[model samples]
Target: MTSAAAVPTSLLRPAVNTAHAARVSVLAPTNKAHLGNLEHLFRNRGAVESTATAAAAPVQPVRRRRQAPLLRLPSFLKRARGDVAAIATQEEQVYLSPRLFQPVPPDGPSPRGDIAAAWQRLHGADGWRGLLDPLHPDLRREIVRYGEFVDAAYGAFLARPDAAPGDADAVRVPLHDPAYRVTAPLFATSSVGLPSLLALAAPCAAQRTSLVGYVAVCENQDEVRRMGRRDIVIALRGTCTVLEWAENVRAGLVPATEAADAAPSTGDASAPKVECGFWNLYKTAGDGSPSLSEMVVSEVRMLLKKYEGEEVSITVTGHSLGAALAVLIADELAGDGGAPTPVAVFSFGGPRVGNRAFAERVEARGARVLRVVNAHDVVPHLPPRPGGRWYADVGRELRLDSRASPYLRPDADAGCCHDLEAYIHLVDGFLSSHCPFRANAKRSILRLLKNQGANVKQLYISKAVDMRVRLDAVDMPGSPLGRLGTPPSTVLECVH
Candidate 1:
């Protein structure tokens, strides 16, 4: 559980209504689209990914005008927003990052208190109407247009008997399936999935916990990719060849189906499902065994076997720590797991993964991995700037540095153009899931390119500086000197 201290009272402040003003004096359009938009600059051309949704016209960037205050929100939360001033530096230079939101109603008893419960009540299926941004004109239309998939995806899941009400939040199949849970998904995936798995791993900056996730995952893929000579299809009975499937996967052939088929299969009946990540907290082998990233990479090899030489859509998604885990799994697939399937990986609030060289390399190789974050959400800033001692990051590490807020100027370690909500608008643009990608079929295509699979657009993302509280000019929470320390009130923790 998050301790009250760790939770930060400031996070509980009023829904911030402040805006981070734009700093660029000359907002010039790119002649051919260089790495200008924080979203575009973050891309390493080689890391393009392919997606698996119905295609639409290629997205062209459009500028969004700053609008007036959308929702005033509760007063208590407002104080929190005012708190940013306590830490105000000599220059009051607030580092800025691109982030991207809308509105609602009135009525009986203003429901509130605690974000999670608040979301449940106001944004609940029945009361969600109370949360829209009244200032945004196309709000509901946006929801129906770009965001209908989330609802549809839910409906699709409901069609499956395994996707019962208890499974509503299961995330992936492995979390719900018991047959392979005990063995862990590792063993089943190793021989079958490692090839495709490593193919998906890319160079990373891995800032903060994302830094840890990247290091852990990158190292795992490095080992698996080194151990690449084996076949992908070693028979479960131990009689057939050990990983003959590797050759097939190398040639882009999918491996054979696993034993725990939706119907029936010939492989090991108890091999666990492969996808893995942090569920509240990520668990590792106490005896010093495989981590979730390792296990998932292993299962992916096996799972990809079924898709090898076959055309299939593979997408990986995670929120917070889970997003970090997703990166590792995707990386492993791209590098070592058998036969890379078209892949897309989406992570929310992820930290930087690598340096210019590594990011460039990933881009050159054609893989697409996108991240979404709110400007005030500071998890991505943890562990301090990479290359420093791990302890440098305790709160002091996060002190509103360039990496955390993006209010600072761009440097070698500065810029990242990961706005996904924009793309979501073209395909999945509306409905407004708090994570910023502009939802759509394009995002799926972008994911594929990152996985190194050839398919659609290859790569793209949403506009940063989303329509939420623009962290442009405002600094601390409240009062004269302005923007420092934890404010009793908050500004922009509002959610959809």
Candidate 2:
């Protein structure tokens, strides 16, 4: 467990809501349409008719009066408006690279802690919003979008048992059109083959909505096919179900022997270690829950056999308890030595699922593991480190810097940070950039196209400047009364 001192007090404080005063300057029209209005303003003496027809038709000859010259907005103002609009329309995203949090001291025994410290510094004190600008825009977008899909899979899982893929909220995002909906449903158990299971009532209706696993044929295979492989997405919903939380509370840490024994089939000499409870959760589907491991393996085999000769990659995703199971499933698939290896695993707000051995083995398998952690989410720090039991999280952790609030209070029994909604919000915020790209782009173009004079428009004037500076003019007495008339000394005092 990390000490209290490890977490900064500033991080615990409520976020400061800085309200910016927007200056809405209604200037003369810059575009032709608006310029027409300006022309009308000068011609009609600022009393132009509101009706479009009246404006369209020739205006009645107004008494010719001495009219002040028409006021046209400067070229800079036109460019600024165009630049602002272009920036507002452009898509901007933020990406945080794991490489950015490198080991401080470059070589040390506590590099992980150093990395954590570096992350805290960047996240806690940086002037920018918590996340770093995106290192890879496209990749970050894909990850963020997919995290949403995985979250929505819970709604799909909670739908009626007989619900088809295209059924109302059946699958959060559709895999296909209504005609090619996912028909095959995946199921898993509450307890890993534990005897005499307790069948609890479903939350809302007669139909049980707590089925564990989900797998569907890649209805939209464009992304996978692009990589020269067919794909199936398998999603495991988080611990909203009663028994799922019950299993989590059980919190019994056992050796990897039991999990290794329950493997569908063993791998070669070097096999990974995994959490016993999680392994059993996959293995034992009791009366209410279906055996997840068997079902998942069976589905994978069938898909491979059906699509023989084609390359297939399975992407597994989940959150919280479901994340733990997803890790186990990935480890199992990799160990089974199956045809379609688990290509990628995305676990959001996931708890540590296995010992160091398990993590190393999973890393060695060449599977892309992206573990997302919301700021100070309590669930991920779970099951306790009783008696020095070794439980560690797998994959590279992608931390989302969520503001601490009453709902997201770290000490609360029911963690607000653990909620998928919060995770989604943080993830989305991280994946988006509100940086003034249009303004920056225009500045860059102006610098390249025009001389130094044009670059003056790109300067940023601080809005917080104190304009009440003291300016005074005083006559300078000639030294030794030599010069009779001397120009007054202008004093310019600019306040900080």
Candidate 3:
């Protein structure tokens, strides 16, 4: 836990509501279409036209006043309006035309041709120079897969909120790609002083410690051969409790070395600094348990030792708050010279974690970070740099626009914009910034939206489209589970 002496009272106080302001900006239109429409509607509100007299008096020639020069819309607004119109037209067609029920593509492993050869580039070694613009198909698949791992963490926590960490059956959902096996569950305790709503909601919240994520390993030899390395994954879910949300609001910067288990510092002003709240959450421990940092470092070290003398890579993934933690974990893991491996982070809708120097420190350790952001999501722009506190984004960014997807409403709320499921959905259908959402995106839109508690009544999903393809448990070459004949049926409603 952070020492009281280290954090000043001013830093602990809640800052201005910049997050809300950013959210309002995100929801506001970037074009003048709404204003123009209103103007046109009320142009002659109080004036009554005499149609009969005007028709009768048409014989006389009338002098016309020169019209004022029309105001031109900005180029970006023109593009925004064009995209909105295109999406509207597409949705209209889907609603008016006969529904086409096509067989959904099987959810098998997407053919990532020689991922082993280009894994470094995919992992942002060269800052993903050419891979992000067109969005390399392999990278897209990997992003979605890691995103699913994060989703699985959410499912686990929701299913058994009080379940002890490291429970073998903690994760209830089977990943689309059954290449990885859960090794251990990860947990974190809040060090914030604020009163928590979680204490009233669940018994586990009283402890200030809850399961956050899990560590998995690619144990399948086929997957290892295909990837050319044994991959270790650390997947974390976003904030779900009141205490976690409270911790997120503490944006004060503290030296990175303030962490209990952090390395000795050189005692200079140039040392890296991180968000005070995040550091406290990462370093704090429940009653008798180890801090999140200690648990993760210990688990990773053991895994590295077990996979010694083999090509190995570490991928840390999370959504929202989890994304921030993922960056922290990657930095810590990379700083430990004893375990030498390429460390990469795929963060979805994550906020800024630290200052510019902290980012430099992470890069100096050779850790690569790729932040996946929804252009409309406000969370990524959070913990505002008040008085120029030096908060900075730390990696290559892949920005996706929610407007590209025809299935979503144009007026999506802040929650919908920041939802992890929506982020994954956008990633699945994303082709490029210049391209529309892919027509053949195989993920069930209805399923994704429903999981996020979105209104799916307006969403049109054909009966066949609702079904997801799953590899039979026995069909998986090295799956530990016995044969599970068929996947469960998904009943979907098609409301016209």
Number of the top-ranking candidate, with lDDT as the measure? 3
The number of clashing residue pairs in each candidate reads 166, 10, 0
TM-score of each: 0.27, 0.51, 0.69
Indicate whether candidate 1 or candidate 3 has the larger lDDT: 3
Which digits, one per residue and each the tens of the lDDT, describe model 3 over residues 283-393? 888777788898899999999999898988999999999999999999999998875699999999999998889999999898999999999999999877666656888
For residues 343-419, could you state the per-residue lDDT of candidate 1 as single tens digits? 44444444443223333433333334544444444445532444541211100010111121112112312212222
- Model 1: residue 223 alpha-carbon error in angstroms: 36
Q: TM-score of model 2 relative to the true fold?
A: 0.51
* Cα-based lDDT for every prediction: 0.26, 0.44, 0.65
Candidate 3, which segments miss by more than 4 Å at Cα? 1-112, 166-173, 193-204, 258-269, 452-496
RMSD of each: 23.1, 23.4, 19.3
In terms of lDDT, model 3 sits at 0.65
In angstroms, give how far residue 137 of model 1 lies from its true place: 16
